[model samples]
Target: MYANPAATNRFTVNAFLNNDQFACVDGYRLEDTVTEVTTPTNQPLPFVFNATDDHAAADALRTLSHSEPGDEPGQKWPAEIRSLNIGDVVQVTAPDGTVTHLAVDTVGYIEIETVGAAARPAVHPHTHA
Candidate 1:
């Protein structure tokens, strides 16, 4: 994500079926989940919703952060996140039903979705006895 940090919510992040140097750095995919944003002060950010999408949700924040919004996302949305801020807490759910508590941490010049605060290992295929 250092090159562009695309699709990140003013964040450098991504996820896929396979792990990479950047995507899923936190070990959880940002889709198929509902993410809650809060500040160090403990205020939970409300869903940034519109007809086309909820900008604050993981799906939009993860994808739209990389691409531009469509023609009619309208005026309710703000560029407030010109990217996310440090100490902004994000609670994201993984596909296997785990919540990863991430706090925005800036490393050098790049922003990282700090991992292991309360993160769970990503689910993998396993054999059953």
Candidate 2:
């Protein structure tokens, strides 16, 4: 059994059985247990949507700080982040032409999708949980 390292709200550990059994961080094993199974070693972290202050969120607008469809080489981030990691707040351009801000939810050496691209207002999903 293994637990997601990035899973918050619990500190001890968690185990998900192959047959739909679950164990809480506090070690309460769920009924209808199943045998252990091998999980992919490369499983990614879960998405943790977050929020930010109005002034701060507005200030982290990426499009305004850099890039206009295209920017000079290395002057701007690639389609994916080249130097940022989880817990870091960054700016992103939405598909609807909105310049939004988001806090990274999954740390990795490469691009990871388990992050909120939009800085949801009024919901601090990360810190609160």
Candidate 3:
């Protein structure tokens, strides 16, 4: 849910209990006409990652740690691309403890292991820094 920053509004939350509280078919109610369950009160929120370098060749692609290209997922292959994926905003932590945020728009697959002679020549220039 989002609210407009330019608008000024007021809201209120109210509750009433008939006999201290109400109960539902599920469990006890903290308030009237409500029910409470004793499943798991503490649940961890999932992390939303916009980008990830969790590939098997992450070590070989370390040079892309700070590089950002306008890449998107499911698009036609570009002339020069390393690795890519489409996801939510990814929080990146640099070696110096600085955090960076980026939105992954695309995912790419580069077959570095099965490069033919022609493909190998084109990819050799990009494999190195």
Candidate 4:
């Protein structure tokens, strides 16, 4: 079996049978029993976003910090982040509870698919899961 490294929660396998009788080498019927197996390694860890800013920016950040359903099943955004403007400072909380302060040096926006077609300020991080 071969698994895709980028897949977060799924498995894929290819198998070949030796004979057309659907029998195991030991003469047991393949469909008569169930076999269970575990993955050799755990799945990849997910990215966490914890940002804080002043009133308006913080509200915008929180509003955009969400995942929208994709066309494919089980598909979703890996992190809760959005574009940010220059000079905006935000405090991010790590998974271990350690907090780090980050300053936005670039401008970013999140597009909204509305009748008027509007965009809002966002905080884009360097990395996402």
Which candidate number has the best TM-score?
A: 1
At residue 67, candidate 2 shows an lDDT of 34
RMSD of each: 15.8, 19.8, 26.5, 24.6
Order of candidate numbers by lDDT, starting with the best = 1, 4, 2, 3
TM-scores, all models, native as reference:
0.28, 0.21, 0.20, 0.22
Cα lDDT of model 1 by residue, 4-112, tens digit: 3222223211221222224334433332232232323434433332222122343444334344562223322123333333333344443333444443434311222
The reply for model 2, stretches above 4 Å from the true place, is 1-82, 107-129
List runs of model 1 lying over 4 Å from the truth: 1-82, 108-129
lDDT of 4 by residue, 49-125 (tens): 22232232332332332444321233332343332233333333333343333333223322112222111123222
Which pairs clash (backbone N, Cα, C closer than 3 Å) in model 1?
Answer: 7-66, 10-83, 14-24
Per-residue lDDT over 71-96 for candidate 2, one digit per residue giving the tens place of the 0 to 100 score: 22222222322232233344333323
Q: Per-residue lDDT tens digits of candidate 3, residues 42-121? A: 12111211233323122212223225332222112123322322321223333233333332323422222222222111
- Full-model lDDT for every candidate: 0.32, 0.26, 0.23, 0.28
Model 3's C-alpha root-mean-square deviation from the true structure amounts to 26.5
What are the per-model numbers of colliding residue pairs?
Answer: 3, 0, 10, 6
User: Considering summed lDDT, which 10 consecutive residues are worst modelled in model 1?
Assistant: 11-20
**Alpha carbon lDDT of residue 76, candidate 2?**
29
Q: Candidate 4: where is the Cα deviation over 4 Å?
A: 1-83, 107-129
